[model samples]
Target: MASRAAAVALCCLLVLAGCADSPVPTDGADSPSATATPGSSTAIDAPPAATPKPDAVEVEVIDIVDGDTIDVRFPNGSKDTVRLLGVDTPEVHAENDPTEFPGVPDTDAGRNCLREWGERASQYAEDELAGETVTLSFDENEPRRGYYGRLLAYVHVDGDSFNYGLITKGLARRYDSSNFQYRERYGTAEGIARGTGTGLWGACATESPRTATETPIPAADGGPPLWVSEIHADAAGDDRENLNGEYVTFANAGEETLDLSGWTVSDEADHTYTFPEGTEIPPNGTLTLHTGSGEDGDGHLYWGEGSPVWNNGGDTVIVRNGSGETVIEREYGG
Candidate 1:
């Protein structure tokens, strides 16, 4: 009886020892603090990690420099000039390179047609990209740099090719280099625009060039001979610093080239400035008169001093031709 009792006591002690040796079941929350193992961590309930963004850089359009070129600001706060791949538009501004396309003839009539079409192309690009964010993609197989060190890229606006869109609209032609990857696609788009006679292809096809002797110039087709098209009296940034801000745009609505050498633009107080000698306003062309001073160039002239000639409150602008005849008068602000 004593041995049997001893054996039972030993069995009970062994069972209790085994229970203590085994790990205590824990819900982690109810357990005492413990050091985490090297390869393991506590399960965490958290939102899934965010997917990484693509490598393509995003930029804001500073300006639609033309149909093919754009000025952009990058994420790193750097500025660059980007030339679109596979497309070219008519030159709106003069080019430094003598080999550039759609060369305008020296004749006034030929220049007038070029100016009109160039303006349309510029306007079309501005309407689509001005102040918008776009993505710039480069060909991995081709040289990234283009003529003049401008970055050659495919500009995408909301995943649609901006270059391709322009070609389809007939505002641009397929101007592809051997390095261009989208040459075939762009060529096809140009064909569609040409076949349908879209935009410039159809609109300007039958238009005739005008000479200085041409009567009833483009703007006078049914409208006034000349008119004030745009006025920025308040300026875009600061009129105090950027005198060009307070300016007025005059468009020639007539078909004849007007020699504006002695023409005058005046304020209500006779603050008059005369167009310099050799100033010529072409048919359907525009001239901008800046209230601030700078060297004059094509399409723009300076008043040669600063201190706000145009009043933001109310102002009247009178434009007189060389003969002292008031051709256009405009009022604003009041």
Candidate 2:
């Protein structure tokens, strides 16, 4: 009897061990902490949604002036007289304007030729600008809206620029200001146009002398002559490395030479650089002032024997002629 009881006890222990080894199911639910479900598809967290970018303003061209200036009709129904930021076109007199072609002959033939060239440039500009949309950017020096309340903008048409196009076609020359950001590209385009003898080159050829009597003249006392119209910072060559050593330039607007000996350059820092006794700028010329030592170029002025005015950061520059007259002033923020 004892042997039979012992055998039954061993059999019960074996059954209990088998039940413990088997996995038991709870109420029809999965484990709370489990990442994957048995026989179910693998789950993945959705990636965070990307942020959207802001929309850009749209611009359209309505009319063209030579290859540079344009009439752009803004979304607000106002007409904008848009000057191509980096280009200067040959002078074209308005209809019946007595003083239109200064320094150029007013003969019927010369006038007709000038008109034809202007028209041709305008035609080319129209072809490029018509029905085209562009992105417009502005320089800090330019008013958001011009004095006339017209929208002022530097246009980027297609991937290339219409401003550069003018220079490439010789319809325009580079017109840089201290605030212009696209200096290098404009300079290159102007150089190319000069070499090619395109629109303005052929139109204003020395062979055909045009009269200057009809050329427009600014008010005599008008704040500083137009020759000192635009100022620029020389950012080329080694000057690019030193910010403070940057130089400021003056451009002559008229077709004659300008004397700048009595001119003075100053900044907010109270630093003043007076022109040496023999400074002169030719027609449509450029005068540069650098920090370091160097001979003044044919159309440039070097300041500070060998050091630049501003170092490697940023500053403001003001140019004035004798008599405490202001020629040009610009606050640079590089």
Candidate 3:
């Protein structure tokens, strides 16, 4: 009896030991506490990473010149006129240059519309940016001077690009130069504004582009012997740096050979080049007047100006015959 009782006790002890070696099953979903690897997570509803802001310098905006230009004072107490990079705004007539807004039609209705939009754009710039402390970032590819010697920069207020904001509101268009930074972004913003018919895109009907042939040229008093054919304002390479590469071409449209001697090609700034004696243009032939220094060559005349005379933004080219009467008045750029 004792042996049989001992055997039963041994069997009970072995069964208890077997149970202790086995792992307990768990209802992982329902359980408040479950064994898991330390610091491991399921990552339910995690937030996305934040975008990095641009590297920039803090500057005080002294004046908002236009939608794309501002007078800014840097931290070092230096002030400069900074032209906003990657954007172009509608022209607002300055107090000094009342005719600065080029190509506005002579009609009262057209003039009124141009004035209204110009005011809106100017007001928006003043309201949002003038006298504000903002950040300025320059393009890595293009820094310092832009066209016309203005400091090129990207202005940011409260971490958002002010240049891009103008495009979003349709007050500006994407003007991509050779070293175009943020081209895709500015283009996308412009597309969105245009698609939604916002601001100028909706309000102005005359800003539509015209083909070269569609533009009309005024007839000269001598029955229009020649017409201004083409202009290369922004020349390619370091050649543009040299004043001579930029030129305006004139074509003799009449059948007769015309004497260009004593004729003048002048810009609004009064930079004029007088044709030398014995200079002539043959029928259906072209003559190029260069802005830089060069010896007089066939179909070419030099302006001999030390600095650029033509405004890259906008300018009027006035051509006159020997009598000093306006023969051809051509306007380009805005």
**Per-candidate RMSD, Å:** 27.1, 27.4, 25.8
TM-score of 3: 0.42
Kindly list the per-residue Cα lDDT of model 1 for residues 219-256, writing each as its tens digit.
31233466565567897677788777889876654446
Residue 26's lDDT in candidate 3: 24
Q: Give me candidate 1's TM-score against the actual structure.
A: 0.42
Kindly report which residue stretches of model 3 are placed more than 4 angstroms away from their true locations once superposed: 1-55, 94-112, 206-334
* Ranking of all candidate structures by their lDDT, best first: 3, 1, 2
Where in model 2 is the C-alpha error above 4 Å?
Answer: 1-56, 73-81, 90-111, 175-188, 207-334
Off by over 4 Å in 1: 1-53, 95-111, 206-334
Q: Tens digit of lDDT per residue, candidate 2, span 151-190?
A: 3345665444555566666665566432344554455445
Candidate 2 TM-score, C-alpha based? 0.40
Q: Give the per-residue lDDT of model 3 (tens digit) for 45-139.
A: 10011112322456788998877788887655667777887777766764222122223344555556655676787789899998899866555
Q: What is the C-alpha local distance difference test score of each model?
A: 0.61, 0.50, 0.62
